[model samples]
Target: MSAKKRERPPVPEILPAPVVDSHTHLDACGAETAADVAVLLDRAESAGVTRVVTVADDIESAKWVVDASTWDSRVFAAVAVHPTRTKDFDDAQRSGVERLARAERVVAVGETGLDYYWDYSPPDAQQDAFRWHIDLAKRVGKPLMIHDRDAHEDVLRILEEEGAPDDVVFHCFSGDAEMARRCVDAGYVLSFAGTVTFKNASTLRESARFVPRGQFLVETDAPFLTPHPFRGAPNEPYCTAYTVRNLADLREEPVEMIANAVRETAERVFRLPTVTRG
Candidate 1:
């Protein structure tokens, strides 16, 4: 059987405390309609994931994200052009993204940073776009969600040069303990994804533990980075439970404690309503 179509994982036990998925791409997870969003949110709430921040990677995606946010009160939106797509970013797209950033439902300016791993975009263009996005983030008074990949040094240098937004988050942080500490020291939030659950990610697990409780966040980054035991299968927001559990075990804290901490952090970072759903 093809791994991409691997057997769907059974829902894990419900969490004792509700949590938030700080970052997820519902559009990429095949949620194109209200029905699809309903099914995904139902499974997520069943697993105790009460709210989610869905992000867009391009102009059209920004539209999808805003529309999805309107489809359900549980969903919020983050809009920006991904670094890889910034190579073709034009004046029109820039203005459009700025407009979306001001949308009442939009809560963040990001998924923007440099990606040296993929040559899809030139470095210079990526840097230019990164600076512009950084400015937009500060101007909008929203947290900046960064997508750093194989360009940590450059990302940090650029952020330092451009002056980071008041709220900066390293989404799906893949840095070592040292980098994690630096981020925490700078008051930046470190969001962990399912990769922290991989057996081979000892450094990542160590870094996850090193991050302070209030600075920690859990995410699915879904339809990708499926946690171990379901590593090769596509992921959904409900699967954030597995990553949160793994993080709790790593930090040597009770699952509820860690889940609640992350839930609170996500709410503060994204300005989400901390609701206790029935």
Candidate 2:
């Protein structure tokens, strides 16, 4: 007999207030068409995740995310060639990402930075791509959403060398308290993913706890990093609720306060318009 399929985690209770998933990959989560995207967003909305910024990690996904943003009023897009995929990031790819970055629905230039954890791309190439993206974000006057993984030093160095953009977000921030302090001091927002709720993530939890309300945001980074208890389960934007609650409990703050803080920070950083739910 075939092995039984694992079930998806049930959606957590609705948040006290709506929150935004700062980064996710709807395409990777099996969303192909507008209807498919809507289905995912519907589930998220029911759990009070009223808005999302779907990020692209490659040229094709860059185009898809821009198009997907138009499919739903609550969806936004962030475009860039992820560091791991930057091994062959030529002029054509850069231009393609640039065009998509200017899309009305595209709010940021990101998921770009060094990922030393994965040996998919060399350090020089990743740094080169990271610098280019930083410049692109500056030229476009949009926030830069970074994906630093085991490469915090080089990522920070490159951003400084490139004269860093006005707004920067460390998506799925994995650094400890000291790094968090550095990022916050530099005025860069740290967007926490489900990983922060992991039982063994004490350092990460410390970072999360100390980040001021306006300096932090929340995300699902879905189809990956499902919050604790559902750690390995299929994740989606709706799972953001669980992370929010966990963050509140960890920070010793009220759920509504955490929800409102992240929502406000997301709107300001992404320049998203206020969303209303019936």
Candidate 3:
């Protein structure tokens, strides 16, 4: 005899709502097709990630990022030479970045800066490339996005010596309280990412506590550092919610306050107009 199948209990949704992913790499996300971007964006939007700033590490990637930004209003662009790719900054490279900076979608000049941890490029070369990007940011009147890894001293020194533009963003900030204090005092926006959610990310959390509202932001740096619950999995813009949550908890603020601060900081530094909230 066939018995009626019993209905399963409905499971409640557990994922957080969307927030802005201030830094990511859409082109480098390894998405295979237009449908891929569509799927990614859908997940992000559903998770509360309303916007993303896709960073380009080289001229070619920068062009792709800019093009993608044009096609998707929710995405923006940041162009630069990563410390690991300092050798790529030749004449043509410089010209390409300059042209892209003038593009309507190019909002900042980075994920550029020092990376002593990798040392893929000589320290001198990294410094030179960083200086070049900083100069270009000033020339183009755009904010400077930085990537410092085990090279905080050099990064801070260079920025100070070069008179870095007023709009400076220390993306994926992992420095300690002192560096955070210094950066905040210097008017630099500290952009926390998934690393802030790691069990051993006390230093980063402390730094986040020191950064005040209107002077802090958050990012996913997708395809990397997928936060705590999702660690070891591929990260996406939607995962920025974990970072925002961790930051809010660390700063003793409400989740909405954290989101508002991050949104404000991004708009101020990138010169983006106020976002339309739903």
Winning model by lDDT: 2
lDDT per residue (tens digit) for residues 21-75 in model 1: 8899999989999999989999998999888899999999999999999999889
Worst 10 residues of 3 by lDDT: 1-10
Q: Model 2 over residues 4-112: C-alpha lDDT tens digits?
A: 2246778778888999999999999999999999999999999999999999999999999999999999899999999999999999999999999999999999989
lDDT of each: 0.91, 0.93, 0.81
Model 2 clash number: 0
How many clashing residue pairs appear in each of the predictions shown? 0, 0, 7
Name the regions of candidate 1 deviating beyond 4 angstroms.
1-5
- Give the per-residue Cα lDDT of candidate 2 at 3: 27
Q: What would the TM-scores of all predictions be?
A: 0.97, 0.97, 0.91
How far off is residue 229 in model 2, in Å? 1.1
